[model samples]
Target: MSQSPHHKSFTARLRAHKIFGGIKPAVYKADALRSRVMPAPLPGNLVLPLLQHQGQPAMAVVEVGQAVLKYQVLAMGNGPLSVPVHAPTSGVITAIADSAVPGFGAQVQRCIHLQADGLDTAAELQPCLDYRALSHLQLLALIDAAGICGLGGAGFPTAEKLRVSIEQGVELLIINAAECEPYISADESLIRERADRVVSGAEILQSVCLAKRCVIAIEKDKADAIEALSTALQDSSIELLVLNSKFPTGGERQIIQAVTGFEVPRGLLPVDAGILVQNAGTAYAVHNAIVEGKPCISRITTLTGSPLQTPKNFEALIGTPVSFLFEMCGIDKSQHTGTIMGGSLMGIELDSDEVPLIKTTNCLLAKSTGEFPDPAPEQACIRCGYCADVCPARLLPQQLYAFSRSEDLDQLEEHGLADCIECGACAYVCPSHIPLVQYYRASKQAIAERDRQFQTSKQWQSRFQFHQYRLKKETTKALDKKLPGAEKTTANEPAQPFSRDQARDEIAAAVRRVAARHSNRTAPSSAKDKAKDKDRH
Candidate 1:
């Protein structure tokens, strides 16, 4: 693909940045981020929540005190858009109520607290040994029924995307392996450990989505992962595309553009442009869901930073309490000043480590003052426009920042505020260290809520308008029937009549006239009473 002039200018600016100044080109390879240790199993007392995925929270099927085996569906998918929650370990549901989750802000969701029996007993698997025989829709339904979703951070229902693509016609499927965030190495570790499973998962996803071709987009940094995936799927129909090692390159739209040279139009989805992308980790989960009847119970997470005595990767069970994982990894909170989930750039800081791990928990970074330095207090924008220069979406971050700061919501929306991916690229490069992405997220949420309210009001107005129109039509028909020689009048009425607005105004005027006449008739009774009082006086 030919580089656009805009892209060329942006690249030149990026090269001048202090952060990229002395970065060795060899460090861009994927092996630099790969964890040296294999992932370890999580601890007991998994706090599995019902609402892990992006859609409607899965409805709880297992109640408190109920025994649930590993891989057993604890919560079932409520609709076509939802995915089910499963037991990470064989245990008794201790509690079924609200629990704290990291990175969720103020939203508390219903959680199933499981006290493990240490048995780790899994339910009987219904393996699809002959998955080749199953039709596309059949395979998709199985994936949905198993409650599988994108293990990638988005957590959108996998089956729903497939169904949508089947209807809309998806031409290409891009498997994202660009773990672009600074320290989140879960996807890289997964690729290193389960390359074949990841590829198999991609094939299953491709079949269900009915895409003509599948492209696995791995970062040039992860050469080992690229080689492993390429070797595993050498004879398969999947193509591995090595992408540039850049922060936020793993974003669905960015990866899609890098691989297919297609820019997904603003406010439109990948499927709208005949593209469906899934994370490499999500692909592995899909593979297990289809072939092994395994639900997404566990995922690999990177436990790294300077605070921990030893930093490594671990296969964490969904709902595993953050406190337990930290303890297991020898992470002493007393020694560390703060903890952040995901990565320092885009991740959220934890108020407390007691929060349970959700499906999207990819990394837990415990940092002291030196490892991850705190930014200076935010100041006024100097109009450097460095943010816009590095923004992958090619949006004006400074403009968005100004609109958001002023709370000019209309102007914000007009500026395509919703299109901001909140990738923290702007904040990452900003000299003033302004939390531009946070403001954008808050603005987007507010705008989305407003839009939802507007849509609801519109629907109500439409319904009311329809009903009023029907009532007026009926009233007119009744009035005509009641009039003298109504049948003759109807027969003589002209085919071409007044416009609806004119007719409505006339009806309103007539109603007001009739009201006036009624008031006039009642006026005499009050006069007679006044005359009687005057005579008595």
Candidate 2:
């Protein structure tokens, strides 16, 4: 039976649980949502980074000076955790060399530099007109070939996530349309412009995962988006879950809990909890891949900040440089203090404007000196418990901060440091201006490094034990050959490991045999000498 929008909305609200602990920050997304997503002009050059996704970097297939059409596979996914890289426009591969990774400071990774030609030629697409007729595996193959990933800033491969969802069996599929960040409105814009496509993509995902039910979770502030999605889903069974707009409400853990009234336990994923959450942008990409027969060559990114003359969303190609976007927006260079990728809480400040926008960039926020002034000097924690109150993961930020400062990894782990989402809620609420999230992030890295070192130590220990065993076995074999009357053991009899006392006994027995043999020879020589003397007489 098809559910009405009102019934589904009410049901979702009744079953929803309040997110553990979250803050409601001012949402600075009005300017970006003022206009529709504008198609960005093809740049003269594009720098496609290989390591845009989570896992291993993609391996380049095309060489320098090769002419490639749009949507051509330039680099293939190297490992299970990665997705392939596709050409955004028809261009010649000019160089494959190290380039600065966006958002990551001073880090360099391999990139495919392309010189775009005047013509934007595209390769032939193979769209599936009827996805229902195909098997689940076949649909997955198509999605993987298209190089789709979680466009929600995580960049997790979509096919890999769905494969796991299928294996584990998903009950609730949540399409996270909650753009709860302060300045980013990319997902909202995508849904507003292409809600039908997003719905179709959701249906396709439902079929793939065999989900029992699916829902699109959106915030109440996004009335236009909700209406668009509601109209598109009128004939569909997918539900619309309208939630209160709160900072970090769109977080995977928070959203899962909000929709299903179940919190994904610490140290486990949403799939472990029988829930699969995908970004609204990712679903749109899947629709393009399955129905339009298109590859993930471009995405909608929000370019908004106080330094720009006009802030708007752009449907940008994957490899366009940040400088070009700034130029298109008529951003004032003198007023621009820094460019941050993503939102204020979770976004990273890019060190250079030359950084190429990759698959995970949802927003590029150009800040002026007055807009995001330097944080006040960190003050001592007053222990007012405000940080703990705002932590959505229900973690005690005060304790975590102390443990982090002291490098008490065991204590941090016991207190649920791994579950900390680093949403910056604690820092935002801290009265002393302490950077609680920074401490938590550093502690997480320290824990990871410690774990890696411990694993290496275990490997060395295992190798040493094996080496010692080999030496002992060789020594035992040598003793067996040297010792006499040591009952020859048959192949079926396993060699008995010798104790220190047993080894001593074997050495003593060998000594006695040698002594006895010498005495017998001497006695025989004496007898021969006596017999010779008697014969002479």
Candidate 3:
């Protein structure tokens, strides 16, 4: 946590930047941040899903009933986008089967069920004390081995992002500490408690990406976190910028715009703008991976809402069930209505509490029966333009809603539905109480499915076309071999049709002539030659 004497403090004045069309929602995170991150009790059962990150799901390495230690690899990364899944604690693999996991929306994915033995045995770790001495690839390999990914968003592999950033020549690396979502302060809490670790992780990321400059962008409301980061970054080159606490400010594009005043072009990534943004918690995990030699098996999650007696953040394992957290937090079953993962605006309501936590899970809001009731009935759009005015991505929510209702994906794309952050800002400001974000979400899903089908169809079509081309090529080659003296024939003496019977007769005549010559030489010619030799003697 100490700063080097040679390092200079960043003297730039802290300035806040504005983003277009953002709403200021009630940040119900005070109670959650009241306590530090407490370690949750190890559950008897953990449901580790294979597809924890955003890529090809990890393939199971440990079979059923296999004993595994903490930090041991349970599943191996299947592709470049994937990160390995590690054992949260020493336990025996009970089963590997399809199970329900949070953020997967109703679909069951393959999960590794583990029965905790309570001993918490650990495997050997390869900690890098001096990451500066190692090459970027070495550091990234360590991160990959640690299974670190973006803990803030969709759980994109951190190694992959860093690799891409390095390839794109990143100029600025932005640490996203803006926990703008209401009732979710996991990032803020992390930065407040372990700002030094976050700073160190940012430095490692900067080193790996070879970024020219690095900055930590946080909300102005996170005063404690900012103070801690300022203290931690006293002798570092990394800059700290405080942004106004607004809804969706923590979004990648929004944070980018707020920090650098650059909007990511549609259909392009932030890296296209020479910028790389990572979540604050992801930075912390990087620090742990490089310095502490710990894999990303757990994360700090915010558990808050009216149903909990004592709401706070917990460093819960990845596969810990939400029901366990609810029980640990002393949930009032009589008043508990349901659990929503992430913030109220963008979170998905869980059908059952048995769903295990995944990498992207940041918040678990247990709503009371009356709290967070269903939205009002859908009303006709009055064209008041309120939804458009509050959109963070500057997308036409009204148009998107209409297109979504009619299943007009082309129009939706034309209006920039892909650019929509789904922050629920338009829905928050909607006059008709129409769930505009819901419509946009549905449209985005439809577009994704359509694109997937299109890509699959294109692949099949390409294969078919190649197959036809190959057949034509082979047929032409066979004909060339069959055609005799094809190139020798002139225009006036065009090649005649092939005749198998004529070729057979010609071959037979040639064989008969050879036999007649051989008979003449061996019979009467032999006697004449002998008489001539005797006369000469």
2 or 3, greater by lDDT: 2
lDDT assessment of candidate 2 = 0.88
lDDT of 1 by residue, 1-537 (tens): 122333333322211112221112122223224446354564668887777777787888877899988888888889877888888889899999897776554557778889999999989988898678899989988888777677666778888988988998777788888887777778887887689999999999898888877888887777677778878988998887776677777788877666656567788787777778898888988888888878778887788777776677778788888777777777766678888987777788888888887878888888788876777899989999888887877789999999988888899989888777777878877888899988998888888888899999999999999999999999899877785787667769866566999899989999999999788767766878778768989
* Clash tally, candidates in order: 4, 0, 0
TM-score of each: 0.80, 0.87, 0.86
Global lDDT scores for all candidate models = 0.78, 0.88, 0.87
Between prediction 1 and prediction 2, which has the larger lDDT? 2
Every model's Cα RMSD, please? 12.2, 8.1, 6.2
Candidate 1, residue 96: the lDDT equals 90
Question: Which of the numbered candidates is closest to the native, going by highest TM-score?
Answer: 2
Error of 2 at 85 (Å): 0.9
Over 109-179, each residue of candidate 3 has an lDDT whose tens digit, in order, gives 89999999999999988888899999998898999888887899568899999888877677778899998
A best-first ranking of the candidates according to their TM-score comes to: 2, 3, 1
Better of 1 and 2 by TM-score: 2
lDDT of 1 at 27: 22
Cα TM-score of candidate 3: 0.86
Identify the leading candidate in terms of lDDT.
2
Backbone collision tally, model 2: 0
